[model samples]
Target: MSDDRSPSTPPAAEALTRCDALVLGAGQAGGPLARALTDAGRRVVLVEATHVGGTCVNEGCTPTKTMIASARVAHLARRAGEYGVHAGKVHVDFPAVQARKDEVVAQFRSGNEQGLTEAGVEVVMGRARFTGPHAVQVALPDGTHRAFEAPLVFINTGARPTWPDLPGLQDVDALDSTGLLGLKERPEKLLILGGGPVALEFAQAFARFGSDVTVLERGERLLEREDEDVAAALTEALTADGVTVLCGHQALEARRAEGGLSLRVRGPKGEKTLHGTHLLVAVGRTPNTDDLGLDAAGVEVDDHGHICVNDDLLTGVDGVYALGDVRGGPAYTHAAYDDYRIVRDALLHGTHRSWRDRLVPYTVFTDPELARIGLDEQGAHEQERPARVYTLPMSKVARATETGETRGLIRAVVEASTDRLLGATVLGAGGGELLSVLQVALHGGLTAADLREGIFSHPTWSEALNNLFMQDPVEVPGAQERNDPR
Candidate 1:
């Protein structure tokens, strides 16, 4: 099917304003697309439904990480006893923490707004709906509406938290990630309803903030998408921090309880009920594809409401593309950023940047952060390639021991016989930063020998990588030619 869908019958000026490029959703993807297009001397109009910097800067990463930092401080004060420091009666000001988070968000929000202005990109604050493949009608902040036309339309409308269809779930007054951020009062007892990154992160955060936290995961283990060891470490860390984790429990229903909320769950132990002062659901996200009129534009979305995009980020609709959470791959801030590069390159230079080849890394911003990139062991095995798993405990790293945070691991999955770096997972302090090196290794076509030969500074968190590769190896067929160690 042809992607371009500009209507042959044109309307008056009220219909559309022509531009070289029109971008939808001004978060990470839209903002960067606008700047790149503008820099390339193309007339660009950037439309945003809500704030700039998308969810990462506004809601997801920025605010959440800011909250995580507060939790870390609270945790440190509580742990001061081990260092011979008697920090008696520690108290956390929830209002102050929220205030600080707001301050940080506002400062960055203004900077993002200023950047777009400085770049001379037209920023339209409104909700945009597709009129045709290349036509859009936007509802402005005021009651009035405006329309625009372009040869190319890029959709980057980010995703939002989804409420699962559980019985009595709608009756209870609860919070999602977005709603949790707006909470003024600290919950006395909080019940988290998922075991993914967001759920576990919030669980640990609230626990450190003095809330009795309980996490309910439908899977047999936490972070079901991650490797088993990574999940186990996270579960142990959360349990140690006073957060009760209940895995393999399916939340059947939720209801209002005596001054709290109760969730009925079913598992091997049969039916069980969990009670808490507040309920926070971090199950997953739903892409904001609805009401955009994708059907009107001839773009296709899956059952989960994700836009069907190609490897080059092209949607079913011609001259229109989708990226980020809507594209149905990894939903990360940097993934969205990389999508911006792909779309911009295709638009400006006629170059094709395939996201498939690039190594996408993900990190959970918990106390002992968890980061992973490339393929896991199960992925490698499914691909029918012999994979080797290597791991080094965080306690073996001098820096981690010195920091008194030695309770995680660095794992690598190598393409056996070839010794090429396939994937790496780091779960501990600085895991986010450490994952970048692995991304480089994967993208740069480096081997395990390269990692081993590299000079990582002494007594550093990064040095864990060198030791991680020193673990056991696996055998892959036809890998002798590529087995030369660096």
Candidate 2:
């Protein structure tokens, strides 16, 4: 007997390619889930509107981090004298840096495409929208149309940078996070709007690249989601690097100016006009649900435009699910990857997994990376959960002093009665890498004592965890201490 099955091909125009499952948006979730379903002997059709590897590979993580790495190297080279290395004057090659970032993005995207192709998943390039509850219509990239029907449909269309509706802002040329990554020439002066992680990361990276960067945040402080001390530390760090931070300021208008653009901003003091060679709006991201035809599929979205889903990531309609930024919980690539696992287990393994109460870890790739897992000091207080908070300055860490990177601090929040680790924030050098140590401990249900008493390597950043957990709970100046009910 001869086998009749051949490799999957793109759907013909005006044709319908029926499959057991249809995965939309080749993001962190969709791509992985497609491969998983295929490996489990299920027919899967994965459709991507733009590029493969979704936002993380094409724009968010892969490309941004590659540029961030270049900026870090440039920064370190400039500081080589502190390390007793006579490194000559360092100059940033902006074009080369952009080229390297492009190379990395291409390599990642190619790998994702190859993986899906080899997995026997039918890959289609198109903008997909639901024609009905179980049927989807695609406008293919080649100006062709195709339809698909599947019992199980997953939407992972990810998010895009949000442009604020400031007056005259749209008329003037500005760079979003995506646009910033593609710049071949470094701006002489960069004015950033937004104090969030994305905004701060770009601010620092451009500053390190020798741009006179200024961050104009409407919020009262940077990283407002974090504790006040964390915000202060980050502000100080950015300031030390010569980045002017203007918090509690709003951009009222924008216009073309000599040599660049000018923004009129309103601050506590008064109104001021700021000029810059470039403007970056890193305010936030909105989900890609508007064009997905959710109404036809009976899928619900919240006021913020994120698809409404249950704890298991299922949409309102049966057999239809949403994951990643589209579903809108944590907008991290790892969160989306975890969402895939939850869906896979529920669909194939007969095991139910929920996103409820799951611990998500995130890192900001600044000079001294800011990494956090679980609740921070403010979260504990806001929830009114009785917790003990221990704060340790990086100055106390031997490795930090030896490396001349004693600029940040480490804070751990633990359950007062059970001694369980609740959360931690690491803001020193290698903070992101070091947060994993506590993440593993948290996953294993280890107490703060476990981390404090564990034998850590000598003169290393991980060893700082020992001192962080062992120290007495320092009294936060304006924070009230609550008694544990237990």
* Clashing residue pairs found in predicted model 1: 3-317, 3-318, 27-54
lDDT of each: 0.86, 0.89
lDDT of 1 by residue, 347-399 (tens): 77889978887777889999799998877765665566677877788988889
TM-score of each: 0.92, 0.95
Alpha-carbon lDDT of model 1: 0.86
Each prediction's RMSD over C-alphas, in Å, is 4.9, 5.5
Return the top candidate by TM-score.
Answer: 2
Clash totals for all candidate models = 3, 0
Give lDDT: candidate 1, residue 166.
88
Poorest 10 consecutive residues of model 1 by lDDT?
A: 3-12
The runs of at least 3 residues in candidate 2 whose Cα sits more than 4 Å from the true structure, single-residue gaps closed, are 1-13, 475-486
